[model samples]
Target: MNFAKILRACKGMQWQLSREYAFKSDLKIKWVRPEKIPCTKPEKSGDLGKLPPVNEKEFLLDYKDSRELQSADPIVQSLFQLGNNRCADTARYLREQLIKEVQRHPLDYGSMEAKLARMTVRIRIMQDELEQYPRNTKLKVALKELIDKRKKFLKYLRRWDYRRFEWMLEKLDLVYKPPPAEFHWITRKESLQKLTDAHCEKIKEERLAEYRNMLDEQKIPFLEDAIKKMEFVRKEQIDLEIPVSVTEEQIKDFKRELEALKSKREVKVDSKK
Candidate 1:
C-alpha cells in the first residue's frame, strides 16, 4: 500500500510539470478574437486558402507596413501600394534606422529592440494623423494598441537590459509610466473611505442647517445669546466673583433655555400647520 501511494505522488508531480510546460508553450502563439482580428475577413467562407497563412514573418511585415497611400512622397507611395504582397521598402528603412540606433550589426527582424523601434515610429505616425483628423476613431484605437505593445516591450527590455530600456525611451522621446504595484484592494479602500467621509460631511451639514432653521423659526437670538453668556462667564472669572463650577452651571442653564425655546417653537409651528 505504501509503495502504491509513493507511485501515485510521483505521477501527480509529473502531470503538474507537463501542464506547466504546455501552458508556457501555448503563450508563444498570440491569441485573437474573431472580431478583433487585425485583418479583413475573406468574402467567401470557403476561401480560407486564399488568405495568407498566419506566420511570424508575415505578421511582423503587416505591422511594419503603413496603411496610408495618399502621400505625395515617393517613399510613402512605394510603401503603401495596394495589392503588394510585402512592404520591402518600409521594412528596410525601419531596419536601417533601428540598426543605427542600437549600434549593433544586422539583427533578426524578431529582435526586441528592432520591434520596439518599429512600434515607436508607427505610434508617432498614428499620433500625427490623429492630430490632423481628430475625429478618426480608427487612428485612435490603433495608437492605443501600439502604445500597449510598446509598454510590453518596455517591460521585457527593463527586465533583460535596464540601461537599454532607458536608452530606448530617451531615443524615442517616449514617457514611460510604470503600472501601480498594488492590487485592486488599495483603490477600493480609498474610494470607500472617500465616499464615507463625504456622506458623513453631508449629514453633518444637513443637521447644522436644520438646527439653524429651527433657531430662526423660534425668533431666538441663539448666536448673540451664546456669545453674551460666554462673555459674562469670562467677566465673572476675571473679576473672581464666580468659580469654575459656577461658570459650568451657567452654560448648562443656557443650554436648557435653548431646548425649552426650541420645543415651544415646534409646538407653535405644528399648531399653525
Candidate 2:
C-alpha cells in the first residue's frame, strides 16, 4: 500500500474503482467531481464570536438577551423562583445565626459570612443553568462552528508543539470531528462527505488499476488454465463422452475393472462350449 496516497484518499475524497486511465488527470484538476460535488448557495456571514461558549454564566446572559424571553421562559422562571426561595431560606438561617451570635456577645463571624457568600454563588450558578438551557444550546452550536473553522489551525499548532527533532514524527493524522449534535443544514455534511468521497474514489481508481496490472502480469495464466479446464468439463458434460485426458490413477482403475469383466465373460463362453 502507498501510505501517503491511501491517507490522502481516505481523508480528502470519495473513491471508486475505474477501468479507464483518464482518472490520472482528474486527480490533478479537481478537488471534487462536478457531478458528486453539491451546489450550495452562499450563506450570509454573521459575527460568530458574539456567541460565547455554552457555560453557566454565558447561558444566563443569552437567556437575558433573547427577544422572546426578556421576561424569561416559564420553566426557567420556575427554576429562578426555586433558587430565590433557597437563597431566602439560607439568608434567613444566617440572620438567625447572626442574632444568636450577637446574643452570645459576638461581633466577629467571618467564617459564617463566608459560608453564606459561597452558598449564594452556588445558588446563582444553578439558576443560570436552568434559565439558559435553550440559549446555551444555540450558543453551543455557534461556538462549535467557530471551533470547526479553526480546527486546521489548532491541528497545525499541536503538530508544531509536539515537534522535537524529526518533523515526520510530529505529524498527526487529524480528522474532522464535528460536534456530536444536529446542525441547521444537512448540505454542510454532504459537502464535507463529497470531498471525502472524491479522495476515496481517487485511491480506489489507482488501486484497481494496480490490481488489474498485477493480474495481467502474474495471475492471468493461472486464471486462463482454470477457464480452459472449465471449458473442457463443459464439453464433456454436453457430449457424455469420456475425456481424452484422464488422470493416470483413474485410467489404471478403469483398465483393471474392464479386464476383470472380460475374464469373467471368457470363462462363461468356455463353459458354454
Candidate 3:
C-alpha cells in the first residue's frame, strides 16, 4: 500500500468511527471529536508515492548469473519464485527481530550469537527463495529448510551483519525462474546417465585389456586353466585333511588367509616353450 492510499483509508476509517460515536452521543466524550467531516487532502508534493519500479534488466541479469541457484530442483525453484515477496518481507522481519533480541540480551552471548547466525542463514535462504521463485512451492520448502537450518546455525555468531546477508542473497539471484535457458536446457537424470554410462564403458575397457594381458602372457585357454595354474600340486596328490576340530579362532585365521590370497594371487602360467 502507498502512503496516499494508506492516509485515505485512515481518513475513511475515522469518518466511520465518528458516525458510530455520533449515534452514541449520550456517552460523555473524553476527547474533542472532529469539527468538520473527515476528508483526505492532496498528497504532499515531494512524497513520491508507491515503491520504486523494479529494475527488470538488472534483476534478470542477476538471475542469469547464479549457477548454484539455477541448479536447484525445478519444483523448488518455482516455489521460491512464487513466495518471493512474502519471503523477502518475512526475512527482513525475522532479522530485525533477531537484532533486537541480540541487543536486548547482550550478555547472553552464546544464545545471542546462535540466534544471529540462524537469522542470517534464514535471511539468506529467504532472500534466495524470493530472488528465484518468489511465491513458488520450491521456495516454500527451501524457505522452511532455510529457516530451520539457519536457526540451528545461528547458535554461534556474537554479532550480526546484515550486509553479509544481502551479499549472500545477491549471490543467490540465479535461483529464480523462469531461469535463463542454459540451466533448464539439461536434465539431471540424463546427464548423470550419460556420465555413468561413460564410466562403465571405461571400466569395462580396462578390465578387458587386463584379462587379455593375463590370457596372452600365461597362454591360458580359459578360466579353468587360470584357476588350475593358481593351485599348488603335491607330488603324490597327498590327501591332506583339514582338522574337523577347527575352532572359531581357526576359522577366523583361515578367513584372513583367503583375504591375503585374493590380494596377492594372480594365475599366470609360464609357457612350456
Candidate 4:
C-alpha cells in the first residue's frame, strides 16, 4: 500500500479503538469553557486640593478670648459680681480686676492670670444660672463651654505651677479634675507593639489550625499503627527488648545513670588525651 493509504488505515484503526474504550470505561471526558469575569470601573478621585474656608462664627463660638467676652456679653458683668464685691458697677469692677491680675507692662489684654480668672468667674456664674434655669438648653451649652475653658486654664496652670494652680482653685472654689491619661494620639512604639502582638497571635492561630488539619488528614490506619507502637513500647515487650511502663522513679534513675555514663566517658576521653 501507498504511504497516504497506510496513514488513513492507521487513523481509522485508532478511532475504532478509542470508541471501544469509551464504551467500556465508566469515566467520561468533558470540555468546559471558562466563564468570563466582569471588570469594574475605577473610582474617580475627589477634589481634595482646595479646602473650604473656615466659618468665623463657628471658630469664635469655640475659641472666644476673655477680651471678646468682656464688652459684648452682659453675662460677663453678672459673672464679675459673683466673684468680687469691690465696686457697685460690676462691669467697671470686672475690667479693673482683669487689669490688676494682668499686671502687664504694656497693659495688654493677653494675660494668663486674667484669662483664668475670667474663665473661673464665668464657670461659677454659669453653674448658678444653670441650677436656676435647668430647662434652658442655651444656658446648659454655655455652662459646658465655660467649664471646658476653665479646665483648659487649669491644665495650663497645673503644668506651669502646681502651687499656684492649687491656690487659684481654692480661691475660686473650683473643683479641678485632671484630664484622662489616654489621648487620641498613639505613639510609634505603642502602635508597633500592638500591630506586632496582633500579627503574632494571628500567625500562631493559623499555624496551630494548619498543624491540626495536617494531623486530621493523616490516614486512620497510620495513626492506629503509631498508637500500637507506642503502646507496645510502654508495655515493654520482652521480644522487642523495649522497657515496660516507665514510672517517675525509674525515669529519674535512668537519667542519673545516663549522666554518670556521660561523666565517665568524658573522664576516660580526658585520660586518653
Q: Give the TM-score of candidate 3.
A: 0.20
Q: What's the TM-score of every candidate structure?
A: 0.34, 0.17, 0.20, 0.30
Compare the candidates by lDDT and give the number of the best one.
1
Cα RMSD, each candidate: 19.1, 23.5, 34.1, 22.9
**124, model 1: CA deviation in Å?**
0.2
| Candidate order, TM-score descending | 1, 4, 3, 2
Model 3 lDDT tens row, 103-126: 436455355443543445354544
For candidate 1, list the clashing residue pairs, or say none: none
Candidate 1 lDDT by residue in tens digits, 202-250:
8899999889877666555764478476867677787896565346566
User: Relative to the true structure, how large is the alpha-carbon lDDT of every model?
Assistant: 0.60, 0.44, 0.45, 0.54
Model 3 lDDT, full chain set = 0.45
The model with the greatest TM-score is 1
Residue-level lDDT of model 2, residues 1-273, one tens digit each, is 899999989765544444223564564534443344211101111111111122222223224456655466777654433243454444444343333422323544444233333333333333335345635655445444443444444445445654421222122212223344665544654765576688889899999987875654454355455545655665676678665454545545545555555565578679989
Off by over 4 Å in 3: 1-115, 118-185, 188-203, 209-263, 266-273
Off by over 4 Å in 2: 1-189, 220-243, 246-273
Which 10-residue window of candidate 4 scores lowest in summed lDDT? 39-48
Across residues 153-237, which tens digit of lDDT does each residue of candidate 4 receive?
7788899989887776655445666656886654555665565567668889999987864654453345455555655566666
Q: Between candidates 3 and 4, which one is better according to TM-score?
A: 4
